[model samples]
Target: MQQTVVEHMDRVAEDVVALTLRATAGDLAPWDPGAHIDLSLPNWLDRQYSLCGDPAERDAYRVAVRYDPLSRGGSEYVHRFLRPGRALGVSLPRNHFPLVPAPRYLFLAGGIGITPLLPMMRAAAAAGAPATLVYVGPSPATMPFADDLLRSYGDRVRIVETGRHGRPDLHALAATLPADALVYCCGPATMLAAAEAAFPAERLHAERFQPVARTFGPDTAFEAVCARSGDTVTVPADESLLDALALSGRPLPAGCREGICGSCEITVLDGTPEHRDDIGAPEGRMFPCVSRAVSPRLVLDL
Candidate 1:
């Protein structure tokens, strides 16, 4: 983790503040369009926020945070207590929603979900890629960078403030896109579900803040064997694999232990893993925080 100072704090929208952070000693880590950093605050609180600033600028980085009334405490603390010049610990940037090469692109951003997609839009335009961004918010006043998006991108950008009319029909929008256009979306559950039903699985890519409903078999006792050290730990049915590993003196780095963040991921050397993470991890990788092995004995790359 690197110590960073909040260089600037400006109100970008209603109940939203954009923070500019600079590393205390040197340059911050380089980041891509869809990358995010783990923000560690005082009072033993930590949360992940997307990087929304220019990727080339290493001296500083920016992140926009929305005050959530139903927050687990991170967003509330950030809006209520944090200020300019305060210190914050930031982890190296990590990207799970990377942009894949496509002939054409379509972006769907809803409310605060636009944070990561902002840079993506800019990057796509700069690369001369044919792209369009459909941005939706509660109202113009509640959206960050709405005016700039209109003035800067012209016809390529579409803003729909739901206060003036009904929400954007994601199903209808998906029907109008080119056949080969890759649809990248980040938004609320309703919007995501609409896109999922309208677009093919291979053509639609989405980033979810909350885990989708998934069904798995009953949790049972399983052995997590460390391939390198030859140490074995038995994970109980009721307990999480992350906690079991820590008790066995092999704690791994974790974020959002509910399986939303991909921080506690470990490679499966030999086992069938019951993948329960939100980020659809490919085969051979599993999140120990909320995932388990289907096989009785599992070997991990520890």
Candidate 2:
């Protein structure tokens, strides 16, 4: 964890504030686009926010927080109590959504989901790669960095205010994209579902702020064998594999216990996983947070 202080704060849009954080000691670590830092807030509230500033700036890291009335304390603490000069604990950047080099790029963002894509679009444009961004929100006022993005990208950026003109035909737009165009979407589940349906798996990339419905097959009791510790923990149908591991004295590093965060990922030494996590790691890696085993006994590197 890095000790930092809020260097600056500005309301980028309605209910959205951008924070510039500077390390208390040395310079902050470098981070690429699509990377996020886990914020350690008061009362043990930990939340992740995507890095939205220029990667070239190593002196500070910028993140935007939208006040969600439904927030589980992270955003509430940030918007209500945090101020410039306030000290904070932040984890080094971790990225599950990364920009891959491609001939062309199509970025689809919904609401605050635009945070991660901003830097990506800039890098693509800077490299002279054909890139276009379609940012959708309730209105220009509610969309963070909407004005700046429009002014900066001009014809390359398209704003679709859903309140004025319902959800745009993002599916149709993606359907017609050239074969070589890589589609990167960070948005609500509905928007992601549309993109997933339209683009091939190899050409489409996405990051989710929320977990999809965590539905799995009828879960049954299973044995989780820890490879390093040689511990066997039985996971009940009602409990998560991660909780089972922790209770049995073999806890693994974890966060976001919902599986969207990719924090509790463990290598599968044996057994087939039901593979219900959303981060989409290839076979043999499973997030014990919400994933389960298909076989009666599964082994993990732990």
User: For residues 1-302, could you state the per-residue lDDT of candidate 1 as single tens digits?
Assistant: 88899999989889999999998988988889999888888868778888999998998889999999998999998899998989999988988988887878999999888998899888888888899999898898998988888888999999898888778887787778899799899888988898898888899889888888878888999999999999999999998889999999998878788787787888999988888888878788989999888898789998
User: What is candidate 2's lDDT per residue for 70-133, written digit by digit as tens?
Assistant: 9888888999988888888888888899999999999999999999999999999999999999
- Residue-pair clashes, model 1: 0
Off by over 4 Å in 2: none
On a 0 to 100 scale, what is the lDDT of residue 125 in model 1? 86
Q: How do the predictions measure up, each by TM-score?
A: 0.96, 0.92
Instruction: List the global CA lDDT of all models.
Output: 0.88, 0.88
| lDDT assessment of candidate 2 | 0.88
